[model samples]
Target: MSLSEEPIAPTPTTQQDAPSGFEETESVNTSMQEFHQLYQKLLVITLVLTGIIFISVWIFYSLNTALNYLIGACTGVVYLKMLAKDVEQLGAEKNRLSKNRFALFVGLIVLATQWHDLHVLPIFLGFLTYKATLLVYTVQTAFISDS
Candidate 1:
């Protein structure tokens, strides 16, 4: 018989050689912990940036404008939290993102247009604070080395 015709015997695997359910669970738990930590860090950074900018705007601009900005900033925070929750649910509890968070922005814009005290410019700019935070964090992670 030729070498190609020879039957190959399967090597038996030991129980210790295979990954256990506990190990799989531990790895998943570790991944979730890391995700939560990243989410918390992003949230904290966004809040700090919002506070600093809000104070500066209040100092340089009118209280009405500051209040409008605050309203938008708070909405942005809520929208971000909702978005994060949706992201966490992706592939687990949800197949797609929820659009309810976007209603917050639309409501803010509609209110701004109808209200006498609120201006669209400041509110829109304030709403962009979250995007700025995400951009800065992306840049920081890309260029800065972790020690």
Candidate 2:
């Protein structure tokens, strides 16, 4: 066959040039819905555990308050684990939300210990770690958003 009889090459399209479609919007909406659901779940778990700790302290008054604080702290850890799982599933390239969640969790746990009049050095270290995480998250959010 002659060169003129050859099939023409398809034109290449740039990613920035692709037209927005229902698929893109739908996927974004689905991801946002998933994110909101996970956030609500984490909030509910934290609030419920906090309530349980309060009720246990008020009603029973049988256990050491440090132990009560520890129970709440452990529950907070489990809650973090749940959040981590969701973050992983979401495949988030940015971790602003996760870092804030962790920082708030650690701070609340420390305040709870203080409220119960407990002295646990290890918990302070955890707070420091959370603070570091918060710093990293802040930097990441700043740079990623600036792009």
Candidate 3:
């Protein structure tokens, strides 16, 4: 029979026999998984530091200020988490979304500052804790070995 007219037989394939494109996709998934794990680790560190700061503020400052700090820290964490998800889903649109997020964050800070009852300093520090945690984690990963 001519190649075009011949009936093709099905062939069984194993995982190792996957196409190059499939292999590349698998690697991408693995890297994304690693990134997610690192993100969670950073989040946990940020929360713990936030808790410590909240406790200190509660002891040294007024209850309203302490609550504001907690609120700010939680807001920052939620913002970062949402941003990460947005980046993953939007891919090419990340740059635009990032700029939008920065504008939103700055607007929130300005609003908080204008609210006379809310202590701006603690709120600003709490907002910064998320980035500080990420920086510390990145430095640790780059400079420290598991061994």
TM-score to native of every candidate shown: 0.80, 0.37, 0.77
lDDT of 2 by residue, 1-147 (tens): 999999997654864555567558778789888767755655555555455654565466544553554454554555566566656555447544445565655766677567655545434432233234445556766998999
Candidate 3, after superposition: displacement of residue 76 in Å?
A: 1.0
Stretches > 4 Å off in candidate 1: 1-23
Ranking by lDDT: 1, 3, 2
Residue-wise lDDT of candidate 3 within 53-128, one digit each (tens)?
A: 8999999988888988887888789778877777676654545454556775787688887888877777877788
After the best TM-score superposition of candidate 3, give how far the Cα of residue 20 lies from its true spot, in angstroms: 0.9
Candidate 2 or 1, higher lDDT: 1
The 10-residue segment with the lowest total lDDT in model 2: 122-131
Clashes of 1: 0
Candidate 1 lDDT over 19-76, as tens digits, reads: 6885687877898889888889888888998898899999998888887888888888
RMSD from true fold, candidate 1: 7.7
